[model samples]
Target: MSETVVSVRDVNIYQGSNLVLQDVNFNINRGEFVYLVGKTGTGKSSLLKTLYGELPLREGTANVAGFDLKGMNWKKVPFLRRNLGVVFQDFQLLTDRNVHQNLRFVLKATGWTDEKLIEEKINDVLDKVGLKSKGFKMPFEMSGGEQQRVDIARALLNSPKLILADEPTGNLDPETSDEIMQLLFQICKDYGTAIVMATHDFIVINRYPSRMLKTERNRVLDSAVPA
Candidate 1:
């Protein structure tokens, strides 16, 4: 049986009073790698925001990582986020901290308190992202790919069931992009972590095709559906 990590149905996404997307319905299952592709300004960000609890799902029924999105408030957003991980295009690692400290910060913020467990968790994520030895290195001291890996490591700190990645390969070179893609696929396959990545890189898409959700003309199109 496939486990569903993200379920959106009859959802209306908005930015303030402006409606961005309507009647959006989709479900991402465990270990599935899905692509979110659409031109800019087509509510891609809004949909992603709604999933991660950054935007409120005001007029629909949706659930993410077992949390109901309808009527979700600010106080409940953090709890929703802990079950999810988000990856950004730009490596959003903290400038002031080393790789270890950055991951440690997220764990602490998310309510991890045991010092021994914290150290083990940090090591586990770093090892998963292939940054075990670079924990002492500052973000500035690493290459773009390495920094992005640290960003990924940070995302894995909570062992999230779903990861929402926004243009994760946008800033990398072709080779680096390939490496990131491979790593992402490996993680999904190995850990049953569902990934919904938003990207405009068609070349990457052609090289590694998967189910896609396209945003166009105020609606989301699912590739899995027959025309």
Candidate 2:
């Protein structure tokens, strides 16, 4: 049986005291790559925030990477996040650090103490993202796409079970966007890691279609089933 990485049911998502989405329901399984699409204020980001424990799940139940989201305190947020990866539209690489240092920071923050294992894991993820030889290069030394690869490599530091990517391809050119899309899909297939990517790029969506969860009219519509 396929293991579920994210399970949300009858979820009422809120930003502060205001409700953004009602009766949201979905299940993202291992190796599944699902798209979260919607207009700017259609609660796409809010939903992702809820899943990542940034925003509280006020009225529904959710399990992300085996961590219960309901009543999740700030103390437990880091633990939950450790099992999940989050990719942003901007590369968000530290300007002061090289690619290797960027990834090293994350490992140390996540409690990795062995130097040998850290080097091995960083090299492994860099290789996975096609940046095996660029680790010593600074963020500004590389192209936008290459920096983005480092960001992805950082996400892979812990071998997360799920990745929540917010507009990962948003800042790239068409070709670069395609490359990132391919890399993300490859990661999903190769590692059995589930991905829930939020994107507004219909062109990219059309180029590589998958199960879609759209937020519209204050609700989430699962296109994997009949409307």
Using lDDT, give the best candidate's number: 2
42-153 per-residue lDDT for model 2 (tens digits): 9999999999999977798999999999979999999999999999999888899899999999999999999999999999999999999999999999988898888889
- Give one digit per residue, the lDDT tens place, for model 1 in 73-138: 999999999988899998888899898999999999999999999999999999998888989999
lDDT of 2 at 30: 98
What overall lDDT goes with each candidate model?
0.92, 0.93
* Model 2: residues with Cα > 4 Å off, grouped in runs: none
Candidate 1 TM-score versus the reference: 0.98
**Number of clashing residue pairs in every model?**
0, 0
Lowest-lDDT window of 10 residues in candidate 1? Answer: 148-157
| TM-scores, one per candidate | 0.98, 0.99
